[model samples]
Target chain A: MTLILDYEAGNLASVKRACKEVGLDAEFCADGDQLRHAERVIFPGVGAAGSAMRSLAHRGLDEALREVILRGVPVLGICLGLQVSLDHSEENDTPTLGLIPGRVRRFNLDRTDLKVPHMGWNEVVPCRPHPVLAGIDPGDEFYFVHAYYTDPKVADCVLARTEYEHSFASAVGYNSYIGTQFHPEKSGRVGLRLLANFAAWDGQC
Target chain B: MLSKRVIACLDVRDGRLAKSIKFVDTKDIGDPVEKARAYYLDGLDELVFYDITASSDRRSIMLDVVESVASQVFIPLSVGGGIRSVSDATDLRLAGAEKINVNSAAVQRPALIDECAAAIGNQNVVLSMDVRRVEPTQALPSGYEIVINGGRQPMQMDALAWALDGERRGAGELVVNSIDADGTKEGYEIALTALISSSVRIPVIASGGAGKPEHLHQVLTEGKADAALVASMVHYGEYRVSDLKEYLQRQGLKMRMSW
Candidate 1:
């Protein structure tokens, strides 16, 4: 069973609908106790960084999630949820729950050619093979709509990295904890396949 | 690298398409759902359904259409027309509208933008403005007073200022349609569109008066809008969506070609 953690964020309904479309017994888990029953958890978010972190903390989901992840259950974070795994962010001047040893920062490019919000489909080159990206190739594009990227200390944790003005960490994993910077739900077929592989991945925590 | 969006807008009145759309090999494309589904399969970027009947009582049926479209379609769907109150916007939201476009209602009650944006978050709320070019009349004091209710009522407001206020009110996007050049097929009102796009940071979509694929390109490169929203050109089988993308690619505009 896959439980999708529901915080105060956009795209919750879309994610739940995607899980159902993919034929997974997915339930919307609002609290930590409800999430404890699922075989895996999808911590997804869309919108500003600090507001999302505040909502997670306000619901006590942050502490509960920390406990849940420490229990060795598989947890996959998406978009802003993935950024929260980093150490800190320049947005809202707040620190994140450092699940991965890294700091989140904004895209430092000042080129007139590139837009501020990279609002489109962008592909990434896979660094290594994993069940999380089973059906997708290194060059397959995923939907992205943000201005920030994560800078992790250990390069081995990164599964795939995408390029803007410069390359950045697009996907990362440290043990049972995994996170993706792009929104697989928004991406078309390639994205659906990636979510399916993650849902059915053999790497048991 | 933002992908160029090809939107399919279905104007419904009495549960029928306001304008006819041509299908690839089908007989009579009367149903909005089927047309929308066909466009989605054809790799259209997005789909928008606007209820544009001057008079109609279709609260339940309209919502049913929205729900049915949302259930099958995966791309972003925007619905507009008669979105006056927060409750009306909520009805669409419950029916799975990814974005709500407001034109007349927004001008009448500018606060509605903020209210709706607050309820559903700003990214989903799009403030649509309809403006027509004035021929520089001496009697009229201001040039380009905002037109509302399909250009029936004109408000004493500037399009640029309204665009700025709309963005300030938490609108993630704007659809600036030119009433003057609409249906003329000459080209986009790039000057009018540029004014709005330059005023605010949010993505602006230029609508109305698209003659050919070059119009789309001109709007992108010249108007500097993030996107160009079209209805008649694509609806009347003037050009295919892929044709526009190919032309844009040939003209050196960055776009997602396949998928």
Candidate 2:
């Protein structure tokens, strides 16, 4: 059973709906015990990193999440979920759950054309193959509404790279844990396909 | 490269999908949920739901409608109309809307943008403005004046200045709706859109007046808008979302065509 981590940061309904559409039975998991017992965990969020980390710490789900990843359980992080999995975030100057050795940095492009929040559909270019990104083709766009992006210390952890003003780690993975900066739940058909792939992903590659 | 977005605007009046000509003489067309589902199936990039009558009655948005539409549509859903507080924005977000657009209420209380930004991040807060073309004056120098109450009331505020103010107040994006070209299907107000798009660093969605794919292309390129919002063009079946996308693609504009 897949449990979606609910830390009370933003909406979980669309993520839940997307999981259902992909034939995956997912429920909100706020307690640490349920999170540890889940076969796979989907960590999704869409708000500030500071408050999100506070909520996770408040619920004691933070330590449980680190344990789940260490236990080799498949964990998928989306947007803020992915950002907070890093060591620290420039957003609100908050420290995150050090699942991956990296930092989340905000976009400070000098170009006027490349706007902050980088909102809208952009292509996700796969840097290497991974089970969760199976059906995602080259130039297949995903919905992204974020200002900050993950910068993993290990280059091999980056599964895919996307460009706005420059190349950034759009998808990163470590062992059984995977993270995507784009929202698969909101990417339409291509997004649903990614979710379907995640449902069947064994966290092997 | 990021693809230019093609968003379908659904104006809901009293729970029914409706179309308006310059914000008046609205005709109920079909069910919003069904329409949203159909558009989603047709490879639409995003969707915007405007609760047309919510402001007048001081009623909240139709969450049931948003919920039903969001259940089926996997694309990003942005909802506006009668969102006066963070609670209202939170309700829509809980109902599966990724973004909440605030127009009239935000104009009335400029701090609403700041409050919503604090509550639900700035990226999800879209500042929607309904503007009318006016002669350039000392106070309203952009020649575009911000109008509220579904274009019935003028706020005497300059549109360009308001755009900057909204961005400063933590709005991530702006939906520049032109009352002059809305539902007319002639074309978008290129000058108006270009002015705001050039002035702000945030993404600008040029709303109102899209008859064909060419108009969309024009607004995206010439008007310098990041996205184009259409209503009557797709709502009345004049053109499908695919037709518009294909046309734009052929015209050398990158679009998400994975469907």
Best by DockQ: 2
B132-244 in candidate 1: lDDT tens per residue? 76654543333555788766676767777788899999887888888777767788899888777776777878887788988889998889888777777776677777777
After TM-score superposition, the amount by which residue B202's alpha carbon in candidate 1 deviates from its true location, in angstroms, is 1.8
Q: Candidate 2 recovers what fraction of true contacts? A: 0.84
| Per-residue alpha-carbon lDDT of candidate 2 for residues B1-259, written as tens digits (9 for 90 to 100) | 7899999999998889999898888999999999999988998999999998744543444888889888999998999988889999998898889899999999999999999998988888999999999999999999999999999999999999999999999998999999999988899999999999999989999998899788999999999999999998898898999999989999999999886
lDDT of 1 by residue, A47-160 (tens): 677888888877777777777777777788898889887788877877998888888888878666565556556776688777787767755767776778888889888888
lDDT of 1 at B14: 56
Q: What interface RMSD does every candidate have?
A: 2.6, 1.0
DockQ of 2: 0.83
In model 2, which residue pairs have backbone atoms overlapping below 3 Å? none
What stretches of model 1 exceed 4 Å from their correct place? A107-109, A112-116, B20-29, B53-59, B136-143
Model 2's TM-score against the true structure: 0.97
RMSD from true fold, candidate 1: 3.9
